[model samples]
Target chain A: MRRAFSRRRKPWFAIAVTVAFFGMLYLPIVVVALFSLNSQKSLTVFKGFSLRWYRAFFADHDLIGSLGFSLRISAVAMIGSIVLGVALALGIVRSRGKLGSAAGLVLLIPLITPEIVTGVASAMLFKGVGLPLSSGTVMLAEVTFSISYVTVILRSRVAALNPEVEEAAMDLGCSRFQAVRLVTLPALLPAILASAILIFAMVFDDFVLAYFTTGVTPQPLPVRIYSAIRFGVQPTINAVGTLMLIGSIALIGLALLVPRLFGRRESLSQLL
Target chain B: MSETSAVRLDGITKSFGSSVAVDDVTLDIRPGEFFAMLGPSGCGKTTSLRMIAGFADPDSGSVLLGGEDVTYLPPNKRNVNTVFQSYAVFEHLSVADNVAFGLKRRGVPRDERRERVGRMLDLVQLTGMANRRPRTLSGGQRQRVALARALVNRPKVLLLDEPLAALDLKLRRQMQVELKQIQREVGVTFVFVTHDQDEALTMSDRLAVMNGGRVAQVGTPEDVYERPADAFVAGFIGTSNVMTGTYADGRLTLPGGVSLPVPSRLGLAAGSRVGAAVRPEKIWLSDFEDGMVQIRGTLRETVYSGATTTYLVEIAPGVQLSVLEQNIDRSRREERWTGGEIIDLAWKPEHCLLLCETA
Candidate 1:
């Protein structure tokens, strides 16, 4: 009877699909989070709740080393991309020509191209330049790839800025450069911080790019987890995954909340 | 406050990609005087203000400030500040910091800057709210902040580009009066740009009416409103009854064969086309005085809006004349003229202007 009525109301027809979508999305994460507290290390067995895997995750030195390396790369990459991207966004927005628009469009290619293709291309570029694949290479590649995301997020904000503020600055007393430094950059601070949070979250647990660009010994945490999974699944991997999930969630929440703290309306631009 | 000209635009012309924004126009603004540039949108008023501010460079001519040519100087190099129509207050800074921005750039002592900023905030009446960001203030409050910010520097000249356009009508009127008081207190040269004729007429010591990238006339508000040079000026500054007729032997003959004597001192050639202009209020209904041009017409409509009654009189089959009369309670409920009644219109000959060609 509910199905019969659902055929008449279109929104009712979407209920089952919506439920299944959320169920598929969160069920695995919930299971992983639930099993990270299990006592035994079996894959399918229901066990009483314990913190043995969490303890094992804390005790592993290699995992801890990889986590630290990934955190450093994420921090460096976040700052690097933001600086370059803000400059690029400002330049692109102010430049007026066909060439400028063409450059703006070209900068968006990385976002549309498959991640695997970018990973393979970066690996090949490092090889061609005679640079060995190391944690430094991963940071360089991550920063290079993440710059487009920052520019894409920031360009609209730069374009939307009121040009009169700068003119007023100059009219008051400041020179042209001083106007930009004092007025324009300060107005764009909220968007810049929002983009930084998103970039940190994206670079922290990124797998495919880091896998291709990282060193042989001390890989990023996602690469480390992939390697450990291939050898044999450890309950410690579940604990690591749960921790990364929580961290990413916190970062995403911060990104969405910062713009609103500045009285901005809700927008998809808050996300990557 | 010297007698010399504070700002001058000598033969200024500006063009953008084949469209002329300001033609070869010349204007001189008096020192410490509140001068207004009045025009419709895209009539080069704002462009003229921007040129004076050094934000825009003219293709020809020069901008002079206090007898010095500063045409090529940038805004920071010049001693002029503008309050934009958008009220472009710095969102990141507090009200006091925003007001002190110019003093800081000029390297004033920190204590002096604070005292000056405090005084300006008091002048604009936002002293207690100095610590709040501009974004948190209301629209009227933000406008005051922008005003205080520009005036704190005490620039030699202040340019306001439709600064009150963003506020509500009541707030805008309030700002206009307060701005006049502030301008007097500071004694700085004010160059105001607006499309509102009332604002220009009320606040300006003198004004220039512009159209199509050219100055139509430059005069006092009363002079422009009373003695317009041409048809456009007469119609633009106020509502007027302008009728085209043929001039022959000191008399203009209308299409309906009603000939009224033109002022011969105008010196127009015989048999030349001319326009006779008169303001609505200048025409009376019951005076019948000597040397007055008298005519009769049937009333077509009557508009009573509490204070005044406007009567549309049809002088001919298709030619209508607008006559205005004050409603000073004549106890004429039955005697007041209604529609379809013949009425006499009378005005002095000097009030009936015979306009010749004027660009």
Candidate 2:
């Protein structure tokens, strides 16, 4: 009886390690959340809870402009990358022999290369091309860097689709393009919507690429937040962080819910 | 009735890399006839169907539909639809929407399309499930959806690539009867492809037996079964007890040094090698009729299936003949013979078939 009980004992060490890992990861965010509601200006102490910093965040025109700019950039980047990434994924999956394999390998380069390298390279390319550094440049750079991620998420999905389904469409009196537009696109809707939401959230919170490519006037939100932190620590920054965190969590929930809306009971993880 | 051929393949040949998937072959399918292309896997039956459906282009020859050449046309331009082996139902579309897909592509009016789709759903017996998704349906229900989706288009011909190959045995048997009835009602020439010989024999009006990328025979089910063209056709269509022997004057000498009288063929020379095939059910064990060829042998084994019983008789040292008898009026199971008993086997002379080629 004792041996059986010992064999079935709870793993205290593993439980403690898991709890400590989660605590270490979330303690700083918890602190930011705690101080964002603190009503005082001090970072080390929490006073009575209030919404003053959130109100201050709404009142600052510079930060609001940056927020709007980041949102527009994310929207544009998400659309651009999804279109190009889906096309690239289709090409890579359908093209036969060496060219398809080579393109598949080349698509992985952006995903594996360090983000700092990609940021520096994009900044240099824009400057070399004599293009002005602005929100447009940031949007273009983010689209370029994010295409590989979208393809990674969507390529497996496209490949798993039955080729006969497309053939069936053509057999039913649809032209090649109509077959792709009506049948193939609808079949890939869940994955496409999932990847779109993911890319939107990723591009919104991205910092390094936005920093290297933004113009001087209304920079992206992450870049604007970095500048504010350098100047002085403000509780409103914690409020902005909390808002972005909530937005990301919302995007993830939307991703998990999109497939169910399409009558597929797939989770967000399976969509990718 | 139209006098034109429904589909005609003129010496079409296709190759993938170094292997020839389909050799030079020509066939003619009559109007409104249920034609089957029967062969084992990789015997070019599906490839030929693809060529006819315009999914594949023949390397050397042309494909003609209703006496018009459509050799280089794309599948969209051809007046034919295929029910894929996988069924390939659109998971996102409702049953009615799936049936209305081709009609909508052709700019069919909304009211007419809805009426036609409704009628088609009724024909496939999925009348009330119009608004349901394909993922909610069972395997047999999905198969009906695929059939309705293709038949609703009213194509000149319909191609089915083993559509019932995924179903269980019970469902497959039921669908076979329903498919035949639906073909009669629709009156469209169905170019069905399947490897199961039983399916080909029972469903098709005429079938083409293919072997090694070539058409070995094309005939009605009765003609093919009664008079097989070669050893391969004989063995493929059903189980035939094929025995090879040397032929002499009105007799064949087996390898075991026994001689059996065989009908003489004018084309076979003396002392030529030949193969003889007899179906298991043709050989009788007792109560033989007059003028029947009788051979004595020792019963080596008895196999009792539910409907019929088979007895293996060793005629010579190594030669064995199988005799099948229906177990219908006789319920006394203990009265049947066991092994090591001498039994006289008799079969009509015409029931034995002589073949010049081996599979």
Candidate 3:
């Protein structure tokens, strides 16, 4: 009788823990989505569903321009991060002795240091150099921080790889560069792609560094949303937020699916 | 194609801090002969192989390939290939692409590259799995892919760093035979590194035994096994029943006051101490006989291993000796020797080898 009671309660205990964990994470997002569909322009009370706020957000040219600017900046930053990150990871991993350890610590500085410190210091440096603070500066800041993350991820992946593959390639009549390009790069492609997706998402969602570095004329989406929230609790803001949340979710899902589909050949190669 | 040394190492030495990994040593590998460097771990066999591959530069000494000084040449410039222990297959490419990588980089025409890759895949018996990934293949299949990738370039020499170390017992045994056949078929000078005595003995035309960063012995497997130069080589090559004794007048005096006739080739001076090594199968066991050099010992254990029955006999205080006998039939006479029974152990003069005792 005791064993039957315990077994019946075990699944309930598992379900309770899972539901509690997800509720703590996504309950706020669900509330925001509900408010976005409410007819009344108030967050505290629920109202009947309406599409007026969604239509208003779509028609707003300024908001759309800000979103476009954010996308463009993130795209550039992600590209820059991936290139610099991969190079740095390779250099550090190949270095020997004390030099390698020193290189590793240098790459880790941006990853471990406070983000605000990096942001303010970079802003000051750019100002001192007499460079105009613009969306480009924001992209530069985001790239600086995101590249460190990319290096850390890619370095671990590269370190885990067997050096014998590169030796085998060179023995096969490939030059050093060709060996790296043909063997090393392909082995690291999945990790590089994964880092790029992560960096893109990070740069897209970043606000503190962008706020300090962005110019006056062209605020990024985060900055626009911040200012709009400070002014008033408009239903259109909720509509914009809901659309962005949905779009980001879809993009992350696509980023995850692409590697599985295209990387099948790569997985096969690894088997060989 | 020219008449030159295939691969040569002159006074090569490598050190990490104060500890020397590869002591100053020189060797030459002939064209199309399988040479094996056999040693235990930390004996610098792998280090020597790495220096030849240009992955690690020697602290001193020069490396030559085809009589050209390639000591400072990068690995890419050398006409040599290696089949690594891990097989090192690129995880992101198909087996065909991995095998074709070298040919592709040489700017071979695409059609020619495809033909060569297909031939190599066939050579390694991985033709049907060209499009399959390495992870999907068995350990032996991956090893063959690695072999195909290295062999496709038709290098002057091939270096294998314990290539069969990862396989299970059955696969490793099968691969041992296959590797020997493949090396002969390719007709390329092969330099293999391994610690397994059976592997070195079965696969190599000549085996170089290394110990403590030094070449202990280099000879044919039979020469090394039958006539080991030192105590380490004697103990390492195969199982041996060893006893230390003093030599005088073509006779060896054991600890128990038993003097046995020595082999004629061991020209040791009288009163000089030496270690005698005799194979287990060579030792004869029988009931005690008068007027014969013999040692009395008790049979401690008997193990019947289908082909042979091995008896563990205690020859002296704290000293155990192993005796092996061919199992011709399950006769009562053979089964009569049980544990705790006294037995006499003896061997012929020619069966024992005199080895140098290391200081």
Candidate 4:
């Protein structure tokens, strides 16, 4: 009885580890968020509350331009990756041959390769192709890296869909393409929207790939923050970090809720 | 009344790689008729239905719908609908939207679509469930939604691939009657494919019995049930006591030296192999009359199934016959015939069916 009770709650040792783990995880982020609202510009000391850091962060033209560029890149990457990923998933599911299964496994390589390695490799590929690094390069790199995530999330969903639904569409009066457009797409709407939200959130705050692929005139928010922090941390950077963190949380919540709104049996987090 | 063929299959054959799914099938379904394709699993009944729906193409011959050959046409081009075995109602759409799907695809106007969808909902007895999601509906209601959705367009024929197979027993029985009534009211030809013999016998205006990708027989329910064409048809349609015997001069000689007289001149020579098939309920006991052949047998077992008692009586050393008796006058537990009791059985000569194909 005592062991069962201990199992339900945790041993004192485990409880201490849980507290310490979470404390270590959230302490730095909490400090940044707390300092973002401080009147004084001290990392260790929390002064009286003020929104001056947020005001400065909004007033900085270069940082604001970088933020806007990041949003555009993330949005384009989200849309581009979703289109290519959904097409690849459908092909993998329908292609019944040896080459298909091999390609399916090979596609998962991007998910396992280190993010730094992928960033460097993508930069070298652009250099080899004689293409100038810019926001387009960052967007392209983000889309290529995120396709695996989208395909991984949507493969099972495509399989779970009933094939008869499409047939019913065609029997009703839809051409083959129209059947896919009307029936198949609507059935997959919730999953597609959830994946889109997730992909957008991932690409928005992504740092390593953006650092390697972006041009010098303007940078994505994360790359800009990293460069700014190397010189000296500013309270405005904290303000920007807090805003990005909030956006990511909101996007994650939207991803988890979209499927539920459609009354689907799956949650997108489960796919992740 | 004038009659016309609604759907016709001429020498249709389909093969999947090396396996023949449907072989040399030729059949005609009449307009406004409830035609059922009854067969066991893997017997090409569903394949035949798919061919008609244009989801599958026959390797040879042609499919004619209302005298128009639609052999190579896709399902979208054909004016037909199918109710799949799984019901396959769209979970993403509401009941009304699911019914309006086909009509909407045909570029139907909004108000007309609403009116037709409403009338269809009323027909399927789901008038108040227009806004409900298909996932919330019960199994029976989902089936009704599938029916309503497919039937809203009023296609030339509604091909049902065991649509009631997903329902429970009581719901299946109730839906069988309702489906026949709907087929009559709509006056649309229904090509229903099912494996249940009782369902086929009850609801179909005419049914085709298929076996191993081939049509065994095509006739009215009574025609097939009362006069089966071959051994497969006789056993498939319903239960029959099929036994091998040698026929000589209008008499079948049994193993126990018992001779049963049959109707004369079935065009077979003497000493030919034949099967004497009889329904269990056709054999009579206790009440004896002229023009009936009576036999003596020892009862081996009696199955009391509430409404009727089946007595398995062995007339010879190895020849056994089952006799079904209603528990009408003898409903008490003690009044039923017991095993090991000597019984006298009588059946008319016409009641004893003689098939040239022995089992």
Candidate 5:
């Protein structure tokens, strides 16, 4: 009786549900991937396999410039958010009293607030302050939006760290700043790297904020693709989307792998 | 206390909100002495140790090291180091790098740093594991790493906050001996803190038994154990059977109307309530001698441990005393007295400690 209850039996219903779930999620992506390699410009039919759209995408200097623009924005936002985010995490975890707790609760607003709301508010703030809408504004908006992601991921890591380790560093002859540099930062590096990768991917794929805050010439890739799609559904858009999907997948993979490189086995779910 | 005391805390007190953590703690830790602060949890032993290491500032009074006041100095500026209870070894750095952290910060030359790190690792028996990350080491080895990391700095005084607390029983015992040996070899005044009475007794040259944010007693292990200062000291350092009763002349009258003769103490009044304590091993079940106080009681229970046996004997209603005996002469072990037998418990007069009750 125990063996019958404990035996391994496949439930066809669960298997079908799982298969349906993944198919629904990935079938559109698979179609885009397949059509990115199409030789003809027909959405409903598959043509002979060719890199025609990819070749066209590479030849378009405007699209290439947007791609480079998005990459630069993501890099800057990643570094900028990480520096501010890690410091905010340490401060929130160490500080006591109402101001610290209020700041902590306020930090979570961006994570839950609608991205479009933040984008509109940021653009209006820049305009109201007599600042022009440009790449700098977009970078600023992206960095502000991405700081919450970095801080949320890093807060628990900071809380889990032994406060005594920092004291031990200080006891070992390092000054306050030196203790953080020598001990606390190294301990948080794994989490920081993981969050940096996450922020990079999020900023790279952002559309609403970049669309609202970007300048006229070199828009972010997602905004450029939106403009190109509004004109006509170019097969080149599919190529760009496919490449971006690959890039983000690689970045997410790096986010999951970096902690293990630091000899920590924490998965991304645990981090978030 | 002498001016050359290695570490001194003069009337230090600390409070967190409404609860006091350490109150009026004044102590003089002599040079090259292995001192221990022994207490149960929340007794302010760790708080006092933190104040000494400059991690926590006292609400009042000053901390002095070699006659130099360090009350306001940060931990880095002070000549002291700590081995945390959790063995807070830096997991990111290599063992050698962790040991050399202080020397590097103090601008020690590279060659001298390497030499000192190598020597410290050897001293802690972690010579071959210098290049390994702390994550790969065992708990005992990690403890040694914490020890070597703190000890390598060669501070005027090394503060250990229950450093062996995370190890297993066998490993803790082994490390206790090893720690004492290392303290002697280095000749640095070690201010050890622990809650285990056995560890404190076995390792400390002098120890302060703390209770409720105050030093209940401070002396050598023998002084604290053999002659505790008061009721709290008597009950904490070892198992003591505290019998509360009223005293008159040279006799104590229990609540059950049974009267027993006790040694007259100077400060004890004729009609005052008092508590009398006697160590378990001091009471004997057989071979009674002259001038020994003997009482007949009914054996309530027998607890046979490996090296010793304890018998719970009820001398009066609601009054029980635990008498401990060595389990020597194994041939007579099985033939010993069983429960519910009438027997005599005897102890010398001086063994009964009297504490005058205030309330």
Candidate 6:
């Protein structure tokens, strides 16, 4: 009787826990979205629905330029992270014994250290080197932190791969580069693509690093949003937040969907 | 493609840290011959195969392919392919694409790659499944696809590292037969690695038994089985009842004063310690007669297998010997040598193999 009662109640308990977890994550986002559509400019009380804030935000050239600047930096940073990450991952995986373990620990240090520390140290290093503080410097700083995450993720994927596959390709008359391009790279593509997307999202939302690295001319979207929030909350800000949330959701959705579509191809190859 | 040795390993030695994985070992794999390196785990059979394939470099040896020194060449330059134990099928491509991967890397024309991949798929009996994913297939199907992927390149030598170890008993038996047929059809030098004695004996034309990071013996299955070079080979290759003894005047005297005739060509001096190896099937149970040395003992246990019956006979206070007999109907019931029954065990003179005692 006890087992039967517990089994019957288990699914309800699981449902309650799942709902609570997701509710905690999405409820605030939903409230912000609702307030963005409210007629009143203040968030404390809601009036009739209005698209006035949306129209005003779309007309704001400064917000548009900031968003564009953020996109460009994230794009560059993602590519930089992938290139540096793949090389670091391969090097760490290829090293042998104690040296390999030591290299792995060194790579993981950047990932575990505080992002503020990384930002401050990188900013100071650029200043010391006499390089101008620009969007490029911002990209460089964010990439320094983002690449470690990419490398740590990709290294595990590369290490889990069977070494025999690459060897078999080489044994079949492929050069080392050819084998890697044909076999190893294909096996690692899913993880590499996923890591790139993750790095891009991280760079896009980053504020502290951009704050320490940005120049006087062009600022990233997060820095712009931070300045706007400090002045006093406005409905235009909520309007901008809603749009950014939608963009993030769309980007994340693509990240999830693209893998599913490409993953189907992988399953087909295994069939052969 | 020439009628010469396809691969050769001269004095190959590979070490990992302080442990020598592959000691100085040399072997020549003839073209189109199916050879097997047979040993238990960590005996360096896989390491030696990997060295020949160029996946691993020997510490002090040369690897040759068709008379060309390929010791320093990477695996990509070698004329060999491997079917891994895991099958290692590309998870993100169609069956045809996976098979065409090596060809595409070699810059084969798209049309020619498709044609070759199709032919190879048919050869491995996986033609209709070209568009399906590997995960959707059974283990046997995935294995065939891996074979097609490797064979499509038409490499000079194909290496198989325990390719059938993952299958169930029935499937493994089926694959063993299929693998032998495939090797014959492809006419490639097949270098197979396995730890199962039955697998090596059944599939290989010539087999090398490895032990302690060294080649204990290399010969045809019958040669190695009938005349093992050492105690390790004798004990590893088949079921053998071993007894410590001394060889004198072409005879082996066991610890219990029982004497058995051995071949005179062993060339062992009198009183020299040796090991006498006799297969269980060679021993017979009967009453003792003149000119025949026998060990009188009571039967301790009997095991009735489908084809043969094994008996555990206690020859003395502590020594026990195993004997196998064919399961004839009359012998199965009438000659039921139950526990505690006194029996005399005997064997022919030539059946005993005198081996050097191992430290």
Question: DockQ: which candidate is best?
Answer: 5
Per-residue lDDT of model 4, residues A92-209, tens digit only: 8878888867878988999999999999999999999999998789889999999998888888888888888888989999898898788887887888898999899989999998
lDDT of 3 at A54: 92
Number of residue pairs clashing in candidate 3, backbone atoms closer than 3 angstroms, sequence gap of 3 or more or interchain: 8
Give a tens-digit lDDT track for model 2, residues B1-359.
45888999899999999889889989999989999999999999999999999889999989999989999999989999999999989888998899999999999999999999999999999989999999999999999999999999999999999999999999999999999999999999999999999999999999999987889899999888988989999999988888788888778888878888877788688889888888898898777899887888899998888888888888887778888888878633437675898878888999888887744
TM-score of chain A of each: 0.92, 0.96, 0.85, 0.95, 0.94, 0.85
Clash-forming residue pairs, model 1: none
Clashing residue pairs for model 5: none
Which pairs of residues have clashing backbones in candidate 2? none
Span of 10 residues, lowest total lDDT, candidate 1 chain B: B329-338
Better by TM-score, candidate 6 or 2: 2
TM-score of chain A of 4: 0.95
Q: Write the per-residue lDDT of candidate 6 for residues A197-259, one digit (tens) a residue.
A: 777787888888898899866889889988888999778888888988887777676666655
Fraction of native Cα-Cα interface contacts (under 8 Å, chains A and B) also present in model 3: 0.90
Ranking, TM-score, top scorer first = 2, 5, 4, 1, 6, 3
What TM-score does chain B get in every candidate?
Answer: 0.95, 0.96, 0.91, 0.95, 0.97, 0.93
How accurate locally, in lDDT, is each candidate? 0.89, 0.91, 0.83, 0.89, 0.90, 0.83
Question: Residue-wise lDDT of candidate 6 within B248-277, one digit each (tens)?
Answer: 898777677766676664456798877788
- List iRMS (one decimal) for every candidate: 0.6, 0.7, 1.5, 0.9, 0.7, 1.8
Candidate 4's DockQ: 0.73
Q: What ranges in model 6 sit over 4 Å off?
A: A1-28, A97-99, A262-272, B1-3, B264-267, B286-294
Per-residue alpha-carbon lDDT of candidate 1 for residues A194-228, written as tens digits (9 for 90 to 100): 88998999999899999989889798999999999
Model 5 lDDT per residue over B1-359, tens place: 43599999999999999999999999999999999999999999999999999889999999999999999899999998899988889999999999998898899999999999999999999989989999999999999999998888899999999888888999999999999999999999999999999999999999999988999889999999888888888888889888878899888888788889887888677888888888999998878899999988899998888888888999888879998888888423536676898988899998988765421
* Real A-B contacts recovered, model 2: 0.95
* Per-model DockQ: 0.83, 0.86, 0.67, 0.73, 0.88, 0.62
Cα miss at B32, model 5 (Å)?
0.7
Task: Compute each candidate's TM-score over C-alphas.
Answer: 0.93, 0.96, 0.89, 0.93, 0.96, 0.90
Better lDDT candidate (4, 6): 4
Give the higher-TM-score candidate: 2 or 4: 2
- Put down candidate 5 lDDT per residue, A128-200, tens digits, no spaces: 9999999999999999888888888889999999998999998998888988988999998988888898888
